[model samples]
Target: MKKLVLTGAAGRLGSYLREPLTKMCDELVSTDRVDDIGTLYPGESYVQADLSSLDAMLEVIKGADMVVHFGAIGDEAPWDDILQSNIIGAYNVWEAAYRCGVKRVVYASSVHAVGMHLKTDTIGLDAPHRPDTYYGLAKCFCEDLASLYWDKRGVESVCMRIFSCAQATNARSIGTWLSYDDLIHLVERSIDSPVVGFTVVYGISNNDRAVVDNSKAGHLGYRPKDNAEVFAKAVFADTPPLDNKDLANLCIGGPFATVELGNSGVAALGVVDDRKET
Candidate 1:
């Protein structure tokens, strides 16, 4: 592609994607709310832009061939905050992509969109929205937004419902983990695929204990290489047995399902800040 725009360039997941994205396009424009993201790759540039502002989104996405949208308040927060950054931000992204004629948007959606479902249910791509928190609710809105844009505006999108994209430190992560290597592969497939009108794929590794199913999205060619079962022994040995009564242990959303509406679910997950350095 000639140009690729990546939002949330300063975030943990965005940091890991910057260097690799540079190689895919002639120019990679990385944008975020931060003033700077330290260093950039050879063909990459940084643009400081807020997700809530439609003008800002338009300016940053103006000449992009495709957009990898990861910019948002990643954790649960107050209603107003979720409305501005996640909901409105999502609308701005799709609108900008429509206006600017961008081909596809690879969104970083979360599993919390269906967090209330039982872990044993094995959620598919067609699962109905059952958000656990305000943050999760925002994700549900964006997924629908992606669908609407595709159906009405001819803008393609792939909403990847990512689970835990960190190390398998907790027992829940053993079933939800998405390794960095696998993440890169998934993003690559989402970008390089020939045609995808409107798709929803679970961003998970090849874990034996995974509760989500991706059989429906096989056309995207996202074959995960890492498995969380490798950490099964240590995680199980360190953590206590699951209590089925606890929502965190019983639901697919893990800690997110148990947190208060406006509280931060990430804080409860105890996820390590192991972002890759650029």
Candidate 2:
């Protein structure tokens, strides 16, 4: 690709993706609301932009072959905050992509979009939306928005409903983990795939205890290599017995399914800040 744009460049996941994305395209434009994202990769440039502004999004996404949109609040928040950063932000991204004539959008969706479902039931790409929080509702909105753009404006999109992208620190992560290596692979597949009009795929690793199916997205060729089972012994040993009645323990969304309407769910997961430095 001649040019690729990545949003949320200052985030932990974005930090890891920056260097690798620079290698995929001649020019990788990374954007975030922050002033700076430390150092830049060899073929990369940084742009400070807010996702809520359509003009700013257009400027960052213009002249791009594809957009890897990972920008958002990343957690449950007040309705107003979610409205601006997630719901409206998603509209801006897709609208800007449509206007810019970008070929595809690789969105970072989340499992919380269907978090209210039972963990025991192995769901697939066709599962209905059962958002667990305002944050999750944002993901559901984006997935539908991606679909709308594809059908109405010919703007392709791949919405990856990512599970736990952090370390397998708890029992829930044992079945929901998506390692860093696997994440890069998924993004690569979404970008390189030749003919994805609008697709949804579960962002999970090759674990023995995975709770979601990705057979529908086989065309993307996303084959995760890492497994959370490796951390099973330690996590199980350190953790207490599970409560079958607890929504957090029984639901696919884990802490998110049980969190208050606008409260943060990630705080209970104990994800460490391990952003890769440039």
Candidate 3:
């Protein structure tokens, strides 16, 4: 690719992608609302823009071969905030990509889209959307948006239902943790795949106790190498026993399924690094 655009370049996940994406193209246009992203990689550049503004997003992503749309509020919040950042923001990205003639869009979807389901069921990409919160609902909307764009507009998309891309700090991480290396691998496979019209793959590592089934999305060639089992003992050592009555412990969505709407579900489960660390 000659040019690639990456949204949410200032985000922690984005931090891991910057250098790699910069190498994938001649120019990597990294955009965020921040004035700057501290330091830029060799072929990377930053643009301060909001996702809710279609015009601004179009300007930043236009003339790019593909877009990695990692931009969005990554946690549960008020419906008003989720509407602007994730819902409207998704439309803007897809519409902008369409107008810009970008070939593919890589989205940062979440496991919360199917969070209400039982973890023991081994749900697949074909599983119905059972969003636990407004945040997860936004992910479902975007996944559907991608499908619509593919059927009507010929724009391809890969909605990665990322489980958890942080360190294995808890028992749940044993099954859901996706290392930074695996995250990069997943994204690379999503980008390099030959045919992915509207693919939906779970973003997880090869954990011994994983609950998700990515068999249908194997065409993407995302063969995870890392295993969360390496941290199983360490995590289980300090983690408390699972409570059958607690939605946070029993359901796949964890605390997200237990939290009240318009509240911070992510806060209820202090798992990932919330700070925008680079």
Residue 146, model 1: Cα distance from true site in angstroms: 0.4
lDDT of 2: 0.94
Q: Model 3 misses residue 178 by how many Å? A: 0.8
- Model 2 residue pairs with clashes: none
- In the range 13-130, model 1's lDDT, one tens digit per residue, is 9988998899999999999998889878999999999999999999999999999999999999999999999999989999999999999999999999999999899989888999
The sequence of per-residue lDDT tens digits that candidate 3 reaches over residues 56-89 is 9889988999999999898899999999999999
RMSD to the true structure for each prediction, in A, is 0.7, 0.6, 1.3
Best by lDDT: 2
Backbone atom clashes (below 3 Å) for every candidate? 0, 0, 0
Q: Write the per-residue lDDT of candidate 2 for residues 1-278, one digit (tens) a residue.
A: 99999999999999989998999999999999998899788999999999999999999999999999999899999999999999999999999999999999999999999999998889998999999999999999999999999999999999999999987889999999999999999999999889999999999999999998889899999999999999999999999898999999989999999989999999999999998987
lDDT of each: 0.93, 0.94, 0.90
In model 3, which residue pairs have backbone atoms overlapping below 3 Å? Answer: none
